[model samples]
Target: MTVLHALAATLSRAGRLARAAASGPDWWRGAALYAAVLALNFVGVWVSIRLIAWNKAFFDALGALDGQTALRQVGVFFLLVSASAGSWLAADWLRKRLLILWRGQLTAQALDLWLGGWAYWQLRPGFGAVPVENPDQRVAEDCRKFVEGLLEFTLDLISGAVALVSFVALLWSLSTFALPACFAGQVTLGGLMQLASAFSQVTTALSWFIFFNRDPAGFVAVCERLDGLMAAARAPAPLPGAPQAILRTASPDGALHLQGLRLATPDGRWLPALPDCTIRPGARVWNSGASGEGKTTLLAAIGGIWLSGEGRIAVPEARFLTLPAGAPVFAEGLAAAACYPEDPATQGSAKLNAVLTRLGLGHRLDTADEAALSGLSMGERQRLGLARAALLRPDWLVMDEATSALDPAFEADLMTWLSAELP
Candidate 1:
C-alpha cells in the first residue's frame, strides 16, 4: 500500500480508538487532570518570561554600579525562580498521575476486547488477515508504552508550539522600526544635553580668559543626518494597485480548467495570456518556453499561490503535490526524508531502500546521516522528490523543472518508473 493509504487506515483506527477511550466512565477526570497540567505549564512559561525581564534589569543595574538595585533584583530573581520550579513540579506530578490513570483504563479496555471477542483464538498466526504476534505483550506492555509515549509527545508538541510563538513575538518586538527610533532619540538627547553643559562651562571660561574657539556645528549636523536616515528607513513605500479578481473554483471532476486566464506580476505588469484550456484527468503536461516567459508564474497561479490576474481557474478536489526545481530535504533520516509528510516510523526500511535503489540513490542510504541528508547533491535531492511522489501516490502531481539536474537517460528511466508505478 502507498503511504497515503496506510496513513488513512491508521487515522481511521485512531479515530475509533479515541471514541472508545472517550466513552469510558473516568474520561472526564483524566481530561481534567490533563488540562490542569497544561495550565501549570503556561504558568511556568509566564514565570520564565518574567525571569528574562529580571535578567535585563539586574544587568542594567550592575552596569550602572547600583549595588542596592542589583541586590533587590537578585531577591526578585529567587522569587521568580521558586515560582517557576513549583509550577513545573506540580505539572510533572499531574502528568505522571494522568499517565497511570489512562494506562490502566487502556489496559482494561484492551483486555476486554481481547478476551470478550475471542480475539486471542481468532487473531493467532495463520488464522486472521493480520495476526497478533504477541497478544500478551501487546495487552500488558504495549498499553503502558503507548500511554507514556502519547503523553510525552503531546506535551513536547505543546511546549514547542508555545516556545515558537514566544520567540516570534520577542523577535518582532526587537525588530520593529520604532525600537531603533527610540534608541536614536535617547542617544541624540543625551548628546545635546552634554553639549549644552559644555557650552555653558566654555562661556564662563571665555569671559575670564578671552579665548576664541571654533563653533561645534559638526556634532549638530551629524545628529541631523542620523535623524534623517532613521526617518527615511521608517518611511513606508507606495503600495501597488489592488490585484485583479481571479475567481478560483474547485472542480467537481478531476480535471484542470482555465478560462480567460491572464497572468500578471504583483506590480501589475501583464504576462503572456494563456489560451482557455481544459486538461483531462491524469494528463502529463510539459510546458516548454523561453526563460522569463512566465512559465513558473503560470504554475504558481495554477497552484493558487500567485493570484494577481484575471480569470477563473477550476482545480480538481484531489491530493495535490508540488515539486519545485530545487527539492528541499529535511534534516531527518533516509526513510523519513523520502516519505516526508508521513511518520518515518510508519515506513518500512526495505521499502525505503527499494525506492532509493530504483532511483539510483541506494548507495547513500547507509552512509547518509540525518545531517547529511539535507546536503545531498541536486540530482540526488531530485531523485528523493521522485521517490516521495512514488511512495505518496497523490492524485495530482505538479513539477516545475524538478528533474533538471538529472542526466537524460536517468531522468527518462525515473520518469518511466513513475509513470508505470503511478498509473
Candidate 2:
C-alpha cells in the first residue's frame, strides 16, 4: 500500500507538470518542433531501457554461450550506437529550433509594444512596474536569454518527470513481492511485499522533496531580481497631465485647455512637477524659468509627447505646430521647405514662395537645392520651421524659444505675421 501510494502521487504530479508545459503559448508557437523533440527524447529513453534489458540478457546468455553465439553481441553493440546517435541528433536539432522560435516571438512582442503609440515615451516617465532597461538590450538581448532559459526549464522539467517514471517502473519490476522479517534469528513473510516497498519509496520521496524544494525558492529569487532590475531601469517623465488635443481644422475655434496638471521624476515618490495648473484657450502662456527649470519639459507635455504623473489636458482637435528650441529643416527645394510636415506635391509653388517671402526667406527658394537638410545654417533652419507653420496654417502654433535665433528685423516680422494669421 505504501509503495502504491508513493507511485500514485509521483504519477499525479508528473502528469500535472507535463500538462502545464504542453498547454502554454510557447508550445503552440513551435508545436511541431516540440512534438518532434518530445517524441525523439522519449524514444531515446525507451531505447536506453531496451539497451539495459539487452545487456542483462547478454550477461545471462554469456554463461551458456558457445563461440558462434558469443559474436552476436556485436550486433547489439552496433544497434546501440546507431540508436544513441539518431536520438541525440533529433533531440538537439529540435531543442535549438524551438528555442530560436521562442526568442523570435518574445522579441517581436516587445518591439511592437515598445514602438506602438508612444509606449516607449511613457516608460521613460514611469507608468507601470514593467521593466524598461536598455530597451535595446532588453528587447534584443534579454528577450533571447529569457526565452532560452524558459525553454530549458520546461524541457528539463518534462524530461525529469519522464526519467522518474522510467526509474519507478524499473524499480517495480526488479523488486520481489516478498515480505522480509528477522526475529529471533528467523524470517517470516505475510502477504505481498508491495506495502513494505511502498513505505520505503514514500520515505525516499519525502527526503527528496525536502531537499529539492530549494530550487523553486531560488527561481523565485531570480524572478524578483529581474523585476527589481527593470524597475531600476525605468525613466519616469518630469511632466504631468495627459495631453489630449485635436487638429485645429477639426475645431471651429481653436482652444487649448489644461486641467489638474502634475509632474514627477522617475525616482520621485511624491512631488509633482506642476502643482495642478490650468491654462485657458487663446491665453498668452509664458513658461519662463531659469535653464532646466523644466521649461522644455512643460512644452513637451503640452505637445502630447509625454504623459506622466496625473491630471488631464483638453484641447479642441486642431492642427498643432510645435517648434522646439532648435528648428528642423528639410533638404528639398524651397517649395518642399515651405510645405514641410506636408508633401510639396500637394502645394503649388506660388503658395510656397508667398509664405517664404513673408518670412524673409523668399531668397532661399531660388537657391541650389541639396539632399542634406543639415547643410543649411541653424538660423536658416529656424526660418524653415516657421515657414512650415505658415504653410500648414495650423490654428495652434507653439513657439518654444524659436525666435531666439532670428534677428530683430525677422523676429518682429515673423511675430507680426503670426499674430495677424491667428484669428
Best lDDT among the predictions, by candidate number: 1
Q: Write down the TM-score of every candidate.
A: 0.46, 0.51
Which residue pairs collide, candidate 1? none
Residue by residue across 24-85, what tens digits does model 2's lDDT show?
46767588887778788777767666665555445445555644554676587578879978
TM-score, cand. 1 vs. native: 0.46
Tens-place lDDT digits, model 1, residues 219-311: 223223322222222331212562557889998677999999998765667888889999987898888898987999888788776656799
TM-score of decoy 2: 0.51
* Candidate 2 runs further than 4 Å off: 1-27, 60-63, 66-73, 110-142, 175-222, 225-294, 305-312, 315-423
